[model samples]
Target: MSEGSSSLPLVAIVGPTGSGKSELALQLAERFGGEAVNADSMQFYRGMDIGTAKLPEAERRGIPHHLMDFLGVREDTTVAAFQHMARTAIADIRSRGRLPILVGGSGLYNRAAIDVLEFPGTDPAVRAALEHELELRGLPVLMARLQDVDPVSAERIGDAKRVVRALEVFELTGRPFSSFMPERQYVVPTIQIGLNGDRAELHGRLAARVHGMVDAGLMDEVASLIPEGLREGRTARKALGYEQFLRVLDGESTVARASEETIVATRQFARRQITWFRADPRVQWLDWSQAGLGGAAEALVANSGVAGA
Candidate 1:
């Protein structure tokens, strides 16, 4: 938790799933000497390319990207762990006198990298009781309690595993989970650039993107990962495209059906991402379709009040 050098500004490109944040980051990095640090949780897993929409090496345009394609599918990654690693990467990039361009749609991941948010440690004794409560009073009761205490987090989190963990953090920290998420206070000097455009247009783009992923061998990707214990990993098993294709492998659906489901799931995820980023007032939104978008962003970063960019 050492203070990051303020001489180098941290630039983050964030927005909905199909908002072209990744491409924009690449453009900005090329324009302003910077290295991209992956904040997309799914892209961290190796061999998860087609489904995660991970850019290939040739497409990276020779720019350095860190925290990407390193972990095995069966390995689990925690937010605290990712925060530590991302901060380390950012520090390293800054020390080398280059700007760190953090790119991803994962709200918590991006926040962990640049914001002053802290992750509470688990209390096994408290966690066990919450799990027992989840088993006894059912998810609704636990969710209601969390809603009463941390509605922001309750609204943000959907799956039971996360809900239970949120409640645990509340109990262990003796504070509302939402209270931990104060307004946009940067842990490092930063410029948060958000990319977005027409909703219907984005929906169409996401649908087409999903179909393209399937054509790029997503089904084969899932089938190949089954032996890698992808199904055994709590987080990896639930990734948008991978989860749907996993259903196809389980004989519960067809490739066409799975493809459609993946599109819908990705679209919904995009909506949630939009909501999450919209809550942060500090974000400077840029139209993804703007002409000379890269040049505009580069100018903004280079001329901004932050001492160094």
Candidate 2:
């Protein structure tokens, strides 16, 4: 844990979607001789470009980005698996004498990369039973059952899979899922820089971004992925734009309606993201619109007094 192990602190850039997190990460990476380790879960899928807002290679300015576009559309990943992948990428970046700039709006994924978090083991029989119940009784029924046992986890978890997982954990270990929530402690030397702005302005930015993606052929991107098994993907099929576009492919919805639905869902997701990052007291916040924003963020990293810096 000594010597070069502590050479540079892991730098994490976190914020809501459309808050310019990716741009800020690139700036700090370029200024500090760093490479990026992505924490955005959706960006892990290989062809989810325009919808996920994955920075194209030409726009990356030749800086290497890890842990993105490494998964097929039909594949899924757990936070535990992503934690290992992210930490390995960080170590690899550091070993090459480059700081690891961890970037994205996926709060839990980011925390798993740098925080002192541990995942609970799963039980096959318990999982199989819970999944059977999910299939028979539906998600809302399972969610209701989880709320009775672990209300805190119920409040924080929304999706069907996570709700089932929370219940599974409670059953397997006799512990509330929220009891395992990670503290603000870091597993390694790390700093978090958060970007934020006025809510109204962000809403407009997000709406426009969604429209831009639509004009940039998001439908085509979704169409192309169908042949590659987008519908079969548990995680990828549920992504914001991809889900809506899938409806369009099924002729169950119109493009305009799908686009509107995607915008609304993205906004809701962004609100959740904001709430998640704001709960972390260690994050140093900067306005996304701040003048000399890059300099301000760079100063925070430079003055952090971590070994190599």
Candidate 3:
């Protein structure tokens, strides 16, 4: 896209987990007539609630939210698919004369919205073969292969799940995964707001959040999903809190241990998110504890020059 073409005003609220991105997005959307769009991968699935830290409708405070809880636990939703959906949602929101606020901590999703990464087209046969390999050799072997074939992508997509996806694209398209990434200059015009705070404070907040989820019946939510046939579903099985809670349900770990493990894993994930967003120069870092939502919203509006804000 040309500089003029890419200059459309879009607001993106992003950060690591427990950074208070959601609350800030809600406040900004309400104040500026914007719609909150989900950029979190886990929050897309239904019944994966407490583990995803999904914002409930009540918590939305009457501001419109797009792309939350629309898919089943068993469904396979890829980042490319999310990008297509997000493009449509953003266009629709802009068409209706409202701002589009891309929100959450998913770096890939944020990158897709702001950059021109073209996803390799899917092939069922190739996907089946990759899935078979995943089932047989497991994720470590596949991840190792990815590191050999496409080290940049291997570094970017470090986890087992993301490694599988990168390999699937490589196998299907016969192209290096890094080739699909658009050039830096091709990034879309967006006001990127990054929320962050002191690391120790954020960790304490994350632990508290995990405990709060437990108090709010996180285990019961997982238990309910198991009976509804989500016991083997990928979405339910891999979610942070739900996965650990499943271990507790299976009597492999006590609730206390599960909570502790979940908190640790979540903290690690947040650190990864922070690393990813920090590497991107487009984001304008903001300390949520230092500034209120109103101040952040005003700054974003002024910087982006979005009309009617």
Candidate 4:
């Protein structure tokens, strides 16, 4: 909130899954004397390391990372909560005379951190009625209704819960949920570095990453968390690999099948992420395989018009 308090630009590293965003964030933070603030929604949960591809502490290379591993599996965080927390982290990092480098593929969460967006209030009664309608009329019916009332939101939202929420917002506020979507306006001095590469190469990397997670004991990790009420967790249970692996644990699916499903799901997720970030003209995209990528990013920061780099 203090515009003149810090001299460093708020840096964000964004890209699809398996595009080296995390490593790039670390390199830039180290170069600019910054701390890493997580915008990845899944990485917020504790004990979700393998599936989320969270960097182990040693791999963090002594850079202090914020807003990670802070939530119980069963806890749910709204975008509003994340926005407040992320802004607070950025302000704190700047107060300490350090740059704040945000890193994640969760597009909305990334925007919430640096964009001038405000969430609308929720009404329990309105939400309850929508939920009741969803149960009675089903998702497709509600989704169709949303298409009529707020076609932009309907096109973007797919899941049952979000569809219901969108309808609720429309009913309560007489405004489309898409009206609240973040504009390309920054709340602070910021620079976004987006990583991308050949689509086929990215697919191969993602598949290999999923297989690597399986080999790294993703099943065992899920097994360990089951006793911790992983199944009861609303959002955590739905994570890509965890969801499939949970089926395997229930004897409803085989690990190989789950792995394959996870690969497919992860690839789809990456595509969505790509679409989300690519639409933002403010982002400066760099290839993941660019030579001297770290140095190139540093040069961007240096020329970003921030007081200090």
Q: Could you say which candidate leads in lDDT?
A: 2
Better of 2 and 4 by TM-score: 2
Candidate 1 lDDT tens digits, 45-133: 98888899998989999899999987988997788899999999998988877779999999898998998878878787987788798
Residues 99-118 of candidate 4: C-alpha lDDT, one tens digit per residue: 89999998888998999999
Candidate 4 TM-score to native: 0.94
- Indicate which candidate wins on TM-score: 2
What's each prediction's clash count? 0, 0, 0, 0
Candidate 3, pairs of clashing residues: none
Per-residue error for 104 in candidate 3, Å, reads 1.1
Residues 75-168, model 2: lDDT tens digits: 9888999999999889887776678999998877998899888889999899889989998989999989888999998888788778988999
**lDDT (tens digit, per residue) of candidate 3 on 114-233:** 677777787778777887888899988888899888899988776766777778778777887888876654344578888888999999999999999999999999898886666667
Q: What are the C-alpha RMSDs, in order, of all predicted structures?
A: 3.2, 2.1, 3.3, 2.3
Model 3 stretches with alpha carbons more than 4 Å out = 1-8, 185-188
Candidate 2 local accuracy as lDDT? 0.90
lDDT of all predictions: 0.86, 0.90, 0.81, 0.89
Using all chains and alpha carbons, the TM-scores for the candidates as numbered come to 0.92, 0.95, 0.92, 0.94
Looking at candidate 2, what is the lDDT of residue 65? 92
**Model 3 residue 164 lDDT score:** 71
**What lDDT score is found at residue 59 in candidate 4?**
97
